[model samples]
Target: MADTGEQFEASASAFGYLFQFAKALHICIEQWMSGDMAWNVAVEAADDIEIHQGAGDRRLIQLKQRAEGVRMTDLSEDLWKTLRIWAEAAKADRIVLAETRLFLLTTAEIPEGSAAFYLPPRGSQHRDEERALHLLREARKASKATKGPLPKCFEAFDNLDQGDRPLQSPLMSRIEILSGTPDINEVRNALQGLAAFAVGHEAAQAFLARLEGWFYNRVIEQMQTPGGRPVTGSEFDEMLSDLQRQFRYDSLPIDPDISDMSFDPSQAVDQQFVRQLGLIGVGSERIELAVRDYVRAFTQRSRWSGENLLRAGELGKYERKLVEEWRSRFAEMAEELGPEVTEEEKKKEARRIYRWVDLEARFPIRSGCDESFVTKGSYHMLADELKVGWHPDYSARLIALLEPARTR
Candidate 1:
């Protein structure tokens, strides 16, 4: 079992990570809306979040959040730690000073007469790089004579300021401290405000949830790659535009996750739709595809219903159309077969009907619901309920199989 202090530290660390991730997401949305097209955001690359224009210019941001009313004093650990990381990066040439801007965003406020207090933008009332540098130099001197993390931070800071190199001047000049920065909730509200332009008030919550879901997944994909391209502003814009088009009056949302979902035919082999395919002598590979479409359609419709994207009796009406179309096709196939059909001939004709439904059928639930799975899988769903089937004798065959269990 872990000690109480260790547990507290672990929980605090987890909270810090959550805040950092949330902050990164909030920053991405803001930059996507207004930042330059050339700049892209990278997570855990050069800093907590780095907005860079290729290999040349960068905005390295460090985020820190504390409990309410906590002021970032001159000797604060968060300030020193962030400075140490940036200083070490500069000293190591991992970042070029000439084309990089450093941002320290914190929920904590910096008081008057502090080093950070003088390090806001130049036009601010107390903005003074010289004064800030002087204060930092004094702080470094004081820290050098002490023990623990402070000395290490000051050592990194001093390393950049040493000799004729004097990198700290340019570095300090580029530093911008965004004190009393908005917390996570405020940032979420800001994102929702931006989402309103794409999707109106009623659908904003669902739209934002889905947009953030995609954005987070995209960020994770980028993070996992060793040296992948950063998530760009353009990608976010494209994704948002696509999602906006989905929410339009004629269209419905297609979940990317469901579209790419993996299917195991074995798990659904006993299902009625799979049995219907088997009765039509559909091959194993084709049966597998049918099961996939069925599951995707079922899950997608459930999502639509849960999200309230479908109207009252809308799905029933859609299914009725599907059943009606299948009925017409089945009747035409039956008439062609006549009363004197061999088992092999019936099987071949059933396969033809199934193929037509699989390859040529196109009944969109809505004018804009263009995902093929929704229509294809919904057919399998109807087949599952015996409302529609590819095989001409699927009902009689299924009833014969069911009657034995009923008698038992």
Candidate 2:
């Protein structure tokens, strides 16, 4: 398995893309709302923006996206400090612009408990922080209005210098329709789990195997062209040796190491390699299919049929208690198995546990240990384990499983 550095790099890139996407989306929403042919919009902060409307008013908009629900703790104190400074500057700039406004836009409406503090801008610092305090009170009202219901849009605007027209018009319809930032936290958590598995035993081996397979494909691809310099047998051997040295798995017996744990071959194998080979009319697809079949057989064989009994509620209270005790013991055994276990075996165990946890977490059985189990393995092992029976075309299944759980 590879180290955390690669995974961290990948996640960072993904988050960066998400941030850019949010910024572009914010601009799109502004264009859509204002219907103005020309407007100056800038994403001034990660979760906030500054927009100068075509109508010639300076507006500051803050956007927040909370997937699991927003809380008071979700507001960063540093962000508040920054906002305080910005507000002061914005107020000062109002002297030049003749109109200035601030707006807070959120994906999910602010929760009632935290709503009091998110409203429009208040008076200058010298006056009662009443303007800021009033801003909070207005935010609380808005939050209450949108609770448990998704609003079409949300916006708050102020007129700093002009008494003739208020900032309310620009905000009323514009803010609610804007899409919140993409939820990067979800991907981060997923990557964290994957990284943990990479450090484990069986999963690590499987991951290495997948990586090796990927490298092998790259070599083969290079070899096939008419003028291409094919990889010599010695070169291939040397590359394998180098990989083994890098991963420190050359001394281990591949089969026993992977098999002993509960490696899900279907998950661990990189199907993309096989698919690419198939497109080239190569033999890799056949080999991959065979490997997948073997892995599936191994996983099915390792699963405890007894655990299915937990779903029925057929066991008496005493019997149920006994089962829980057995599960605890099994978990302990799994932990011990990690150190002495072959990498392959560790992978298998890790995959089975990871799949079980994933399924349980998504479905949430009322009374079961499925969600509580842990999978431990190296990066390769974890990836393979996570791949359990997952077809390359499993997106439909995932959507089917998740659709019911999503809030409208």
Candidate 3:
């Protein structure tokens, strides 16, 4: 989604920072992994960035990002272009192909069958170039469903001289693909990984500060050139806003979480999943706390946190209990409110209760953390998934909630 070129300039704007952040992470991590002190990233016509470890140890790092889940079909064209750049660099003696690494860093994971296409189906001892070319041909032949020029480019490359063939005839093992769900957590984790190798806290802080400044400059440059039309200061401001809209947690100031603890599924908004959590004999107060956390996170548009909350609703029986317990409480409260509460008011309460039972029944809570401490981006999901089936009268109220103007 981030790399889709057909988007209007406004839509593609966030990519400026998304891409730079990923590149910076790769640079720091690569430096740590390779123990290469003298390296410059995103320099001198290299793809995304170049990592020069030594004479023959130069590497090309290409960063690709997708806003949604990635598929091989989605990558073909961009992959071709990146491959071409590296292949030409190798051919021109600008870098040694064998010693250089080609890293395809993305924000989406490659699906099962797609992994084999990146290589020769896992087990073949064939050269990477031949394998890359073969996949390219087959991908093109089956390209009726795809949309791009990658297949055609690969076709032409297959016909070129061995030296000029970027992907069709070569022996290179330094190809790697790194992908993950795009979120502040991803960026934070990357920075955390780089922390181990940083010279000190000051150095790490300086690197991040520089990266932020670099992103500001890069966005300005892209805004000015922007292919079709020259950009104005206003447009650059819009880009920054768009970046904040999607990656506010990363792009804005917030305390970072650096703990190595695993993600707690209880943080999700899944009703059934929360019911499962309830199975462990969690108290009502804890569930209420979790629900508040989940609801707040969802209201804040914390996508990853919402996913976690939704996961809780996946287990059937547990969610049912949660829904029943919540509805039962509402019924008791309605009785206490007595006859002044119309049947309509009773059902309205049911709708509200049902929405909660369905969405925000679970929230992330780990040991030693305060009750009010909810992670940024922690949210609810599975709003339609009530532990108990919907009642017709109550459903109307829920529908009304969805369409506020209907009643007003």
Top-scoring candidate (lDDT): 1
- Give the Å shift of residue 354 in candidate 2: 63
RMSD of each: 2.6, 24.5, 18.4
Residue 318 of model 1 has an lDDT of 91
Ranking by lDDT, best first?
Answer: 1, 3, 2
- On a 0 to 100 scale, what is the lDDT of residue 69 in model 3? 60
Taken over the whole model, the C-alpha lDDT of each candidate is: 0.83, 0.38, 0.47
Per-residue alpha-carbon lDDT of model 2 for 155-233, expressed as tens digits? 2223222465443333222222122433545433443344235334433434344433544454345435543443333
Where model 2 places Cα greater than 4 Å from the true spot, the runs are: 1-17, 29-35, 45-47, 73-82, 91-98, 107-109, 113-408
TM-score per prediction, in order, is 0.90, 0.26, 0.40
User: Which TM-score value belongs to model 1?
Assistant: 0.90
- How well does model 3 score by local distance difference test? 0.47
TM-score of 3: 0.40
| lDDT by residue (tens digit), candidate 3, 257-291 | 22212344455534543453343344566556556
lDDT of 1: 0.83
